[model samples]
Target: MKSLKITIALLLTAMLLACAGNDELDGLTADSGEQQMYDQAQRYLRNRNFSLAVRGLQLLESRYPFGRYAEQAQLELIYAHYGAYEHEAAVEAADRFIRLHPQHPSVDYAYYMKGLAAYAGNTDLFARFLPTDVSSRDTTHAREAFAEFSQLVSRFPGSPYAADAKARMVYLRNLLARHEITVANYYFRRGAYLAAANRGRYVVENFQRTPAVADGLAVMAQGYIMLGMNDLARDATDILALNFPDYPALDDDGNLSSDYSLEEGQQRSWLNRATFGLFDPPEIPQFDTREQYE
Candidate 1:
């Protein structure tokens, strides 16, 4: 009985979608042809009815591939998909527009929209309110977003969107740097000294000037100490002290302090240990983070 009900519900949804599509098609039957459909889509978009806008735009494109409204319809489809939070569809539409009209003046906007969609695609409703570290999560969309933004800035320096694209690239670069630092911290805490130190070196080399570089150096020094490489550890510590004198990991002698130890992380209060950190919550690692988005 439950299975039958679910099947019936799915059939109803399909039928409703078919009917909606027909209604949009029927509305475009006026003698004005492509203009009528395009106008209808514009109205839906202005009213923020993205679903209807998407349907109308899709119809306009299919029915008038070479019509005067075809190019505009394709561009609007990208915006419609983005507003509806269909990020993949938005990116695909943007790519299609750019491919078909590479030299068009508005192609820059398409590239910008693609990058924006990819970035927002990584955002979740809850994370908007809570303090979440997006970099520590899956980086596929973040990397994609970064690449798109970089392309826009490199190809269209004087374009109005280029400045904003550059700003977003900064944010994305810092996020990637912080991700590597976080991973290195995990290896450090787990006593995998070589793994931890390599991650720290990667951040310093690949993501220079980001705020996370200080922590990366700290991780590198600590990892080297655990592996009994005193000279290397001292070198990392000295550079960190020179660049970030106020860094918390520095001691009075300007050497890396021994505070970031697995022992410190494991020494929980008796109350927390008995309750498995329920009574006294285990401390999440803290890093000096930088936020450029205002």
Candidate 2:
């Protein structure tokens, strides 16, 4: 009986120790697995295999949502989408990061990423062209980009990315302004003076800091002249002169003159004579018109 009791006690002790060892081993294994996942995801990112990196990071984020690596994984996922040229996906990821980690030290980076994604998402063919139609092209993404960039500039003025964001904002602002000018010019060519003036004024009021401001003012001047508003035309010209004194004006004879010699009224009158009711604009033949006959 004594031997049997001793044997039973030994067995119970061994089982308990075994259970403890198993628990310890499981903890180590879980930690190792998390580290491996993080390392692998980083490796993929380094290799420029962005899609794979995103998948790996996403798995880590889903599996360990409250773990220390979750925030890092989320941020890396944003970068991965960007590297893959998945702009909309990147923006979504960035936005999520910002919403979740509002107080995180790297939240500024998330905002910057959002701006970059918005800027990158603008795929307008006319983006590179000087004269582009603002009304015809979707400016939603560009506007979003501007807003995000502005936020970054204001919030993280000392950030390394702030300078670049500011510069990009300048470029985008000018692009938007040019787009308005293109639309105004299109209206001018169509003899839609009121529409042209409104579009031009929109640029002046919204994007006055852009280089296109001078051109926009000039367009407004022309528009006012066409509308028999010589005073307004001359006022626009005056503003242009004050803003850009060195800007040359193209005369009816195609001569570039630096002189703003005409009084406000005379300048308006000259603009009216130059553009209003003078000649018929060249017709733009529509492709559909040709197709209809064919």
Candidate 3:
């Protein structure tokens, strides 16, 4: 019964979508050729009427898939979806265009658009309006965008979009590395030294050129020290000193500062736990590895 109800709901949703699509096409009647439809979609796009543009472009593709405007219409649909904030749809449209026209002259644009869509997907309305810490949030879309941009750069190094893609890739890499550091910091604060060390090690291994590597090494060293692994801690500090001598955690004498010492029996106050550690927080050893976003 539940399955049948779900199926019914899906059918109703499809019907509503069909009706909405038709409504979006309002006075724009289909002409004899795809050119007219494509033109109308372009007009809608120019006016930022993304809903109308998406419907008109989709209609053009369906009515005249082999027409001269068919490929261009498909490409335009991707932009229309992106403009409408339909990021997943935009990515799918871009992917379809790339798969169908791999050798086409404008295929690089499809790749660029795919990366752009995924990049935009990572930023939600809250992040746009509020001072949210994006690095502390889920990084699924960031990783996806990084991979997409990487593919674009690898395949079309000379393309016009390659430079911008490279810039965004750098940002994403830093964001990803910072996210790992944030997790490591959380684990360290919560007394999970081994887990924190592992997270820091992951950042050092995977994100070499990112600014977060210094912080990662700091975390690994402090976390290992907390776990009584002095040898491992020394190794981490040595590497940090070699690669990033200016690391904030290092003392003037080139040794790990005594500030990050772990207090074995430090307990959180009731007020601290009640406020989620915002007020009257525990005196845990923390490294300020939050590198400013590049």
Candidate 4:
């Protein structure tokens, strides 16, 4: 009876070893399968079938979290999401890549991808009035995009993407300045001269290097005149003349010249004040009312 029991125990041990070997072989096969899937995904990506490529990549990532292709797969996944117009998904993936690989050489590319995703995610202006809108024209994402691009420009100035990032930054800055100018113009037309002046001044001070700066200074000059602040108006006019000497001016005769006498200046100033006051009430008492009371 004891001999029979020993034989049974040895047989059981051999069976366990055989099962272990089979498990290892299955693992190898699974690895090879994943590799094949990754190769196919790369082929799809190269062919610009980004959606199918992303699907394969997603499966590889999910099935083999610590696989050898994990890092490259994550980066490519971001690009795939971007190509598919999944802006939010792209940003999320890029952000995850940055968090996971902070010191990775390709981290800069991840940051750049994030910025591009945010920038392209902006909704069209006309889409806002639609009832089923899922995005906004609000520049909230632009701020983040600017920050990311600025970081790349500052840290990796000589990077291949740096030049393009800088150029895009210039465009974004100009767009932001233009938005300010639009608001300033609205206020100016509504006789909110002080508000208009503040908005225009913001554009001039913050976006001095932008193309809109000259126009911003001119708008500020007009705003100051409307507010009856001749000194401020004159200062703005001087800046405009120095910066853009050929800028057209709206004189009493509707000509675009800077040729005017002191009387003409005073008359233009008063006319501007009156016109602006029609839309915006003065903080101080009206000149005629003050004189009559005195």
Q: Which one is best on lDDT?
A: 3
Residue pairs that clash (backbone atoms under 3 angstroms), model 1: none
Candidate 3 backbone collisions, by pair = none
On TM-score, the candidate that comes out on top is 3
State model 4's lDDT: 0.69
Where does model 2 exceed 4 Å of error? 1-32, 124-136, 242-248, 252-294
Candidate 4 TM-score to native: 0.70
- CA RMSD of all predictions: 7.3, 19.9, 8.0, 19.8
Winner on lDDT (1 vs 3): 3
Q: Which residue pairs collide in model 4, if any?
A: none
TM-score of each: 0.80, 0.70, 0.83, 0.70
| Best first by TM-score, ranked | 3, 1, 2, 4
Cα deviation at 212, candidate 1, in Å, is 1.0
lDDT of 3 by residue, 1-294 (tens): 686687678768956775676475656555646667877888889988787789888889888989899899989899999988889999999999999999999999998899899988877753654578888889998888989999989999999999999999988998999899888878765666789899999999999988888888888898888788989998999998998887777898778876775543454566766665466655666665555423
If the candidates were sorted by their lDDT against the true structure, best first, what order would they fall in? 3, 1, 2, 4
Instruction: State the lDDT of candidate 1 residue by residue for 89-184, as single tens digits.
Output: 999999999999999889999999999999888877546545786867877788999999999998999999999999999989988888887777
Point out the higher-scoring one by TM-score: 2 or 3: 3
